[model samples]
Every structure is written in C-alpha cells, then in structure tokens.
Target chain A: MSPVNSPLAKKLNSFAPLSPDELTCLADLQARRRTVAAMTEIVHEGQTDHRAWILQEGWANCYKLVPNGGRQIIGFPLPGDFMGLRSILLRTSDHSFASLTDAVVTEVPKHRIDEIFQAFPRLATSILWAMSRDEAMVVEHLVSLGRRTAIEGLAHLFLELGQRLSLVDLVSGSGFACPLNQYVLADALGLSAVHVNRVLRQLRERGLVSVKAHQVIIHDLDGLRELAGYDSTYLNGDRPAR
Target chain B: MSPVNSPLAKKLNSFAPLSPDELTCLADLQARRRTVAAMTEIVHEGQTDHRAWILQEGWANCYKLVPNGGRQIIGFPLPGDFMGLRSILLRTSDHSFASLTDAVVTEVPKHRIDEIFQAFPRLATSILWAMSRDEAMVVEHLVSLGRRTAIEGLAHLFLELGQRLSLVDLVSGSGFACPLNQYVLADALGLSAVHVNRVLRQLRERGLVSVKAHQVIIHDLDGLRELAGYDSTYLNGDRPAR
Candidate 1:
C-alpha cells in the first residue's frame, strides 16, 4: 500500500501534515506488513530483541503479567499508535503486548529506526512527541486508578477513546466501533468483570453510554464528560493543530 | 556549582560518565538553580507556560487533582529526574507538581532546551533515554494498581524506590531517608491513610520492612523482594551502564 493511504500517514496528516518525502520514507518502513492472529502474543516480558511495530490495523493491549496468572493492561494501542517503541528504544521488553483482535502491524526493526533517526532526525522528534502523548494518556489512567470512582473512570475512558479515534477519523458522531469486552474493560479499569457489567448498566440506564455488541454508543457525550471531569487539553496541547 | 558537582551529573556519572564538554553544556542550564519550600506547588494543572525543571536536591510528586479535591500522584520525581519534561515537551502541564520537602531545582527554559538540542543533538537522545526509563517505571506501577494486592503493591513501590535511590547513592544497605508520610503514601498507593498505617504495621510485624518517622528500614531485603516479586531490570536496561 502507498504511504499516503496508510493509517499512520492519514492520522498524522489529520493533525500535522507530513511532507511527501516524509511519507515516502515512512512507506519504506512499512514494506513488511504482517497480520497477527487475535489474542496472539506479539511480544513477551523479558524478551531481549525488543521488537517494534507500527499498528496499521486493529487493537492491541500493552500489558504486564504479575505472579499467579495476574495481568495488567496498561494501554490499548489503537491503530496509528506505535507498539513497543519504548521497549525497543530501551532494548528490552519490560511488559508483554498482544493483539486484542486480528491486527495488521508494519514491523519497524531496530536498525531501520536507527537509520530513520540518523537520516531523518525530525522523524525521531515526531516519534518522541507521539510517545509523550502516550505517556500523558498513561498518567491520566494512573489518576483514574488512584482516585476516580468506577463510573467516572469508565466515563473518562470512553470519552478519551472517542476523542482519540476521532483524531484518526475512526469514530463517527455518537458512537464508534469498540473491540473491548467486559473482561478486557475490567482489566484496563482495574475492576472485576462483574463491576464492569454493573457500570455499563448504570451508564446505559442514564443515557450516557452503552457497550452494545462491539460498539460504544455515546448518547450524551456532554453529560459523560461532566461526570468524568474529562479534559482534552492533556491529550492534545492547549492549542491543537488545525 | 559546576554541572559535574550537581546531583544530576553525579547521578549520571555513577552509571554513564558524561564528557567534559557535555558537563560544561549541562552546567549552562543549572546556573539558574532555585530553591523551593516544602509543600509548595512548582507547577499547577492547566498552566499555559509549560515550564520545566530538573530535581537537583529533593523529591516532588507529579499528580493530577480530580473534581471535589481528590488527588492522584502518578509518580514521585527523585533527584536527577526531570520534573515536567513530558508536559514541557508537549507544551502543557496536564498535572500539578509540588515539592514534598524543601527542594532545589534547576529550571530548563523552553528556548534553552531548543538551543541545546541544536548545539548538542546527542544530548537530546540521552534525555529521550531518561524519559523512556521513566515510562517503564510508570508502566510497572500501573501493573501494581491494576492487579497486585495492597501489600504487594506497596512492597513493589518501596523496593523500586530503593533501587532508584541507590542509583544515586541515597539509599544505604538497610534503610533510606524517606520523606513520604502516611498521607502521601496513601495518595500514591491508592489507599486510605488508615490503610497505609495498617500496612506499615503489618510490614513491621512481618520483619520485612518498616517506615518510622522519616526513614524506611528494610529488615529483610530478600523477604521483601520475594513478597513484592520486584525486579530491577525494568527500571534499568538489560545490561545497565556501570
């Protein structure tokens, strides 16, 4: 596929337009597109090679497994997000990452990244900007885990996802396709599956949001934002790109 | 003080020694060191200026305040840690940062950072490395909050802190000077102050570790590590710099 049509290029063009030459450079890295099966481990904790990839399609969860079969889903790397960038840069996988659904990823080998950084240094800066944005999201989730109530936390997550997907033009008005199930939501929100079910019911009854089948329908985005005290400034800067 | 004499340089020198020219360049920024009183807000949420600082003398907590006066401390910035790099890079403060004790910090102005990035581009790579390390720690904590029990979480945090502090030689064999009170502990660990008190007592009884007054004494380091399942490789790379 051409770089200009790639989800990553499209996402960047939506915010900060990349030059034609930059798109061509990005296309070089996407030469090896591989499809991963749903629920397959793409990278595991303690792995040495520290593989890196750019998500071209579908959802993947970045997580860590604790003792006795416990898992913590840190973040959902949506399409257009870089998977294992930090671990790749640091040269070790600190956590495991897996495809939550059948996904397509363009593998970015370590040497290729180094080549990009040296040949096109500005690309490195842009990648770091994306990483900083990722950290902001993680910090926000940490806040939810530390303080926000279950309802508020779930509300915040939904609103944030809507805004993010909207950036890549994946979310339409009032709803978006969501692949996460109650168990996955429970893992990410630090609640049990039963609690996630109860919270979904509460949101549905209040006409805020509903996770019906495989979609998130945001009935009242304004009300949900108010409940979650959701602010988009953290995700995007004070003045986002036009 | 010269950059070599600064805590930031000392910390880096302990692991990866900086070149003489690099030290001189670093000192240019540290010339504007400022002292802040304990419990003072260095940066507040939603600040437009997006100021940045490096902790040279004391600790600070980077946190986000929710509606109705709830605060969630995402991470504690120790000596040598950049206080607001993520926000400063992204050009907005998503969280508020405050000194936990009377602290000294060296401010890095936005323009100055740009100038350094232009003059010594390699320095930019090192800063990115540090940020990646910081994210690793955050990911680990997210795991604790999501899956680990309170005792296990607290133990993991303490052990992680010890390893981090030891990198700068702030921690001795048996104990370390701890500035966090029960309230702060509760805030960071997602527990109530009463729960923190109980956990401290439990650790004391179990002969693993204890926090008393302003110090944390590790009675049995191996036992505490065993309980926490703590590993240091996440914070440091596979083969860390000596």
Candidate 2:
C-alpha cells in the first residue's frame, strides 16, 4: 500500500486531518519497514531501547511471562497500531512484543519522533491521543479478565477486535480475517485452551459466531455485544475526522 | 497546601523540571478546589464533560459496574494523580471516579488546559508521560488479575500501593495509611470480601504484613515483593525529579 493508503494513515486520519507534509513524513517513516516471521519476539521484557515500531502489516501482541510458568497476553496490536510508544516515556519495555503471524513493522527511532513533534505540534497531540486510546483499551481488557465470565470474555474480545479492525476498513460485513488459534484466545482471555474451544463451539452452536479458514463471522453482533455488555464509548470513536 | 507544595506539583516535577510560570499555571488551576464526602461519585461512566480533575488530597478510584452486579475497581488515583486526562481526548468517561475518602480535587476546564498546551509545550510532553505511566500501571494490574494467584494478587496490591504512596512521602519505614477495607480490596483484587479477609490473615500469619486501624504495616517488604513477583519498573521510579 502507498503511504497515504496505509492503515496507519487511515487510523490517524480517523481522528484528525494531516497535511501533505505530515502524510509524507509518516509515509517516509514506513519506507523503512522490516518483516519478521511468525512468533518472532520483536522486543523482550525489560529491554531498554530508544526505538519503537509501527505495525505496518499483520498482528502483534504484548505479553508477560507469569512466575508460575504461564503467560498472560496483555494486548493485541492491529495493523495500524503503534507498538512501543508507551515505552518511549519510560525508556524501558515492561512486556514482550511477539508477532502472531508473518508481519511487517517500521522502526521509529526516538530522534525521528522528536523531529515530528518539533515540526508538527498538532501531530504530537494526535500521538498523545493514540497512546491514550491504547491505554483505554488496556483498561477495558482488565475489566474483562477481572469481572467478565468466560463466555462473556470471549464474546467481548471478538467484539473489540471486530470494532478495531472495522476502524481501518479491515472488516467486511460481519466477517473478518482472524488468524488466532484457540491457544492465543485462551491466553488473551485468561482461559484454558480447552475452555476456549468449548466456548467457541458453544457460540457456533448458538449461531452467534463461526470460524472457518481462520476467519471469524459474527452472525449476531448485537447479541454478542449485549451478552458481553460491550460499549465502544471508551474507544473515542466519535472524534471528528478532519 | 500551597500550589508549589501540592502533590500534583511534586508528581509533575518527578517527570521534568517546570519553569516558574508553568508551576504557577498548574498552581492556579488547583486554586479552584472542591471537596466531596467519602464514597461520593465524582463522575459516572459515559458522562461527557470538558473538565478534568486533579486529586489534591485524599483517595479516589475509578470503577465500572459489571453486568453481574459487581464493580471492578480500575484504578486508585493517588494525590497528585490527574484524573480525566484520558477523557479529554475522548470527550467521555469510560469509568466512574468515586472518592474512597473525603477528597479534595481541583477542576481543570478544557479551555484552560488548551491554553496551557499552547503556552507550555514541554508541560504538554510531561502530561503525555503521566498518561503513559498510568497505562503502564493498568497493564501491570491486568497481568496480576489474569495470572497471579489470590495470595500473590493481594501481596502485589499491597506492594504496589506502598511504593506509590512512598513517592509522595506518605510512607514511614514500610508503613502507610490504608483506609481501604476488605470490600474495597475484594473489588480491586477480583476476590470476595471473605477471601480478602482470609488472604490478609494469611499474610499476617506468615509475618509478611499487618493491617490495623486503617494503616498497613509491612513486616517483610522484600519477602512480599518476592512472593508477588513484583517489579517496580512499570512504575517508572527511575525518572529524574527536578
């Protein structure tokens, strides 16, 4: 995709307009893209580096290893998501980012970001907005793990992913590409793999959703939303796109 | 407390040095203070308001009511912690802020904040740092809920609260004021009140911690940290205070 046609530009443009120069700068940043194989650890926990990355294509998630030999997937970053902006403030990564599939990402050095902030203050505000949105999603995921039931948690996760993908025009009608397996779903939703399988089967039997060829088809989006008590207000979707 | 001597100033100073004018602007913002009784709801979920708040004194927390008729405590804001900065970008609150104790807070109108950003660009960066830090803490809490055992969760909570309180001089030799009760602890840790009581008793029996008359005393801080697998990296304690 061209830089102007990139998912990152589309996602950011959903919040506000970017001038031609701004778009060119963002496009130039993406010109330095690099690809990694599936399950590659892009950055490890406790790693200190002044560089971040933008997910130009494919999916990645952040996770932390538990003391009891388990791992908790903390977040899933979509194509347009910026992976390491949170660490820019602290200069150290607290969790590890691993690609779930063959992926492409653009490394954003600290100096380049500083230049952006210096040249375009408005873009800096938009960057803050993006980081805040990322935090909001994390907060929502916490509620899911702490309060929601197993079924509700699964449903909420699907709904959230669908909504996010929809923002970048990745969703087609009620279906979208979802390459995640039951194990990934289990880790992200705080369930055992067997439990995730059971939940998926139950949802399919109830005509709520179906998975085929690594795609998730939501037959009852409203029903799933109601069951999960999902609300998109936290997503800040109403921000005017200039 | 005077503006410069306020916890908000101290917290902001932890990130970067503020010029006298910047300090005055922050202090002047806090001049319009309001006090609410204990357990008062400051803002409800989905409420749209252009004003944010700074917690000047006492304790407040953000929570969301679950579909199962339970409340999940999303965060506990310490003195000097700014609330609703996330909402400023979204224009709506995703969680409700309630006072855990009689609390003093300063309202910051959005217009005034815009003025601050225009006049003090560096302060704007500091605000971004604060929000990112908040998100990091939430991510940590998510890991605790998803992976940590009940005992470990309780220990982790105590350690985190102690470390945070100590940042504002609220700790004295491993003890700090803890006005929270078992119910509040249950909500925050995803446990029942009875379970919280049991965990507290276990910690005390193990000579790890003790709670008396709204105060928590750490008998073995290092031991508790080890048991909880606690690391303060996410708290950004290494930031230079100016």
Candidate 3:
C-alpha cells in the first residue's frame, strides 16, 4: 500500500501555503507512479535527458561515478525531496540518483513544470529558494570535505543530517536513523570503507555515538558538536530582513 | 592608474544590461576602497560580524582553516566578484578570505547592503542571481574534487576559469594567466604543494599546456576538454522560463 498523505505536498504548502484546490491541481500535472527496488538506479550519468521525480516515499542517493569506477555520493534526499532539477535546465542529468530503499516516485514532465512555473510564481520562487539552499548545503559540504579530518567529517555530517531531519520533524532532536550503508558513508566522506568503519568504531568507543542494526544514537551531543566545530547558523532558512 | 572599468562587470552586463546610472550607482556603493599587500587577510574564521567587500582588482582566496593548520581554498574571486554573502544570513564569517596578490577592495557595511536590498529590489534580485551562479560553480567544483582525477581536477579548474574569464574578456581564447601561486593551487585542488608541482610538470611534459611565470597557454583545448569532460551547460547562466 502507498503512503496515504503526500509529505511533499505538505512541504510545498509550507513554502507558499497553497490551497487544497491548487495542491490537487499541481499534483495532477505529474505523470504515473514509478517504483524502484533498493539500490536501484533512478537516473544515470551521461543520460541525455531526464524526467523529474517527486519522491512519494523512501530515500534516494544523488552521486557521481568516477572514471575509475569509484563513487562519490553527493547527497541523499528523503521523502518530499526533489531531484532532476538539474535536468530542468541542462537538458541532461549531471549526476545519477539511485534509490537507497524501496522508493515510490512520480515523474513530472518538463513542459508541465514550465507551465506550473508560469501559473504559480510563488511556487517557482520557493523552488529557487530550495535550490539555492541546496547549493548552500553543498558549500558547507565542500568546507567539511576540504578542511575536516575523518572523525570531524563524520561528526559534521551526522549533526547536519540530524538538524535537517529535525526541521522537517523526522527526528526528535540530536539523533536520526542513518539508514545509509558504511560504503555509502565512505563515498560521502571521501574515505575508504575500512576507514569509515574504523572511525565509526572510534566514535562508539568514545561514547560519542551508538549505532545498532538500523539506528544511530548520538550519545554526546556536546562532544560531537565540539568535534565537528558545528554551529547551527548554517542550517537556518530564515535570515534577518534587509 | 586604475583600470577605469571592470572587465568582469562589462561581461556580466552584456547578458543583463545595466544603464550607466546603474553602473555609476554600483561604483558609488564601492566608494570606500582599501588596498592590501599580498597575503593579507580580508575576513577571518570565527569572526563575529559581517563586513562585506568587493574585489576591485587583484587575486584573493576564500578558505576554511582546520585546527591543525590545514587550509581548503573554497574559491578564488576575481575583480567585480562579491564575497562574504554567506555571512549575511549566517551572521558570522566561518571561513577566511585572503588576498594572494597585492589587491584593492571596497568595503560596504552589512547594514548598507541590507538597506540596498530593501530599497532596490531589482539590484537585490541581480545579487541573488549572481550568488545563485556562484553556488552553481561550487557544485561543479564538488563534482570535480569528488569524482575527477588530480590531473582532471586541475584541468577542469583551468577550463572553468578560462570560460568564466572569457565571458569577462580576460581570456583571448584557450589561454590566460593563472594569477595564483603553486601553493594556492595546491590548496584549491586539495593536493599537496609538491603534488601540484608534479602535476603541472606532467601537463607540461604532455604538451597540453605551457605555464611560464604567471601566464598559462593551453596548447591543446580539445585534449583538455576531453580530459576534463567539461560541458558548458552547467555554467550557462542564460535563464529560460521555468
């Protein structure tokens, strides 16, 4: 059975407070539903064209495959997340996005998205805001990868994901279920799988974090914050008015 | 004598036409100018407040410093480029901006910027567009660092810079001065200084490029493009409806 409510629809409303009629109208623009098994490719690199996908449920990973067959996972989008926006302008997929779990998504055609942009300027503005924010998150990631140590890098990522998920009510506070695999974590952190496992063990030993079969509990928020040198200012979507 | 005009500004205004009045208004906003010798710090990490600066002329590096003294150059801004916008929303400067060469810049108080944003929505929108483009460039950089080889990383940077500078007429075609030292290149490319020298030597040996003093001449554009896998679509700023 599919998830009854659309978390993405709610997210869209939160940005602009669209009415029910508008939401229903907007949802109708998307095409038929699609599903992918866990660890399946949703979009591939070097693909000339793309169809925009709105995640109905499940998680997806957006990444680039290196020429040497190595991988670098740039981002992981949860429910309500949008990928394929790059295709909206570039006429191609710049990076491949794959499912991390059984995922239900709906493809939105480019022509319809353009129509929506014209019909709903506020929605388009919200999208621009979201994409710009996505870019800022990339900025933070660049800073972390280019500057932090392995442990620090891992801590920052955890803190980041926790805070982001919390904003959308996914997590309670300092902890979230990190469903991604260690190999994927390695790619995200620019480390080997062995290195990522060793770091994870070190964190567990230090009482900084606890990870089990499917959950990660950040035991020492303050310690993790110190290790990550993390400040929550970067996560704020609202800024002081000019 | 000062260059009398901003080359980069001219290139940008080519796409989005600005009146002489608008140009003069921008020049006025940059009235309070200051010049720093080479290796001067423009903004520092952990700084509590925002102080905006415009690159008037010369080279500068924006980077984050780790506790162990490792540095990661997030980007290099040229003349007419704006820096410190990240701090505008974050309320604190998390990374440092420093000049690589004797440089001149103009300071605009954050309050003044805020005032302008409120008073002139068009100017504000233009700034927003500029920042969006900046963020897009960083995404490309992340892909390069995460997925490309060291040689390919350097090649992509060169090609990207050449294209960007060409838009500003800084490049005649496939050649332009690097305007940065080997050490700066090292940090920017996430390589050691020794590694940078080796890669440059490799590029030279392969007859792909000739670097003398500060000038770089691309001996093989097609080879460089193939090596970098650069597609201009990502950098294209021409906005279409939706």
Best by TM-score: 1
- Across A118-209, the per-residue lDDT of candidate 1 in tens digits comes to 88766666676677678789888988888888999999999988887877778877899999999999989889999999999999999999
lDDT of 3 by residue, A1-242 (tens): 22324556555555557666556655675436788899898877546564677776677888876556777788888776777775663345557889999988887767777777778766676555555456556767886776677899898888887766654557765567768888988888778899989999999999998778867789999999899887665545444311
Kindly give the stretch of ten consecutive residues in candidate 2 chain B with the minimal lDDT sum: B233-242
Instruction: Please provide, for model 1 over B127-212, each residue's C-alpha lDDT reduced to its tens digit, 9 standing for 90 to 100.
Output: 76677678788888888777888898889999988888887778887899989998998889888999988988899999999887
Poorest stretch of ten by lDDT in candidate 1 chain B: B233-242
Question: Which is the winner by TM-score between candidate 1 and candidate 3?
Answer: 1
In candidate 3 chain B, where is summed lDDT lowest over 10 consecutive residues?
A: B233-242
lDDT of 3: 0.72
Which candidate model has the greater DockQ, 1 or 2?
1
Candidate 3 RMSD to the correct structure: 6.3
Ranking by DockQ: 1, 2, 3
lDDT of 2 by residue, B60-163 (tens): 99988987698889889989888887677544677899999999998888888788779888888777667767877887889888988889988998988887
Regions of candidate 3 where Cα sits further than 4 Å from its true position: A1-58, A64-71, A78-136, A172-175, A192-210, A219-233, A236-242, B1-4, B17-33, B45-51, B86-93, B108-126, B172-174, B238-242
lDDT for each candidate structure: 0.81, 0.84, 0.72
Question: Order the candidates by lDDT, highest first — what do you get?
Answer: 2, 1, 3
lDDT of 2 by residue, A1-242 (tens): 88777888887877778888878888887888799999999888777788889998898999998777888999899998898776665456778999999999989888888898899877777777777678778888998988888889899999889988987889999999998999999889888999999989999998898988999999998889898998776665444421
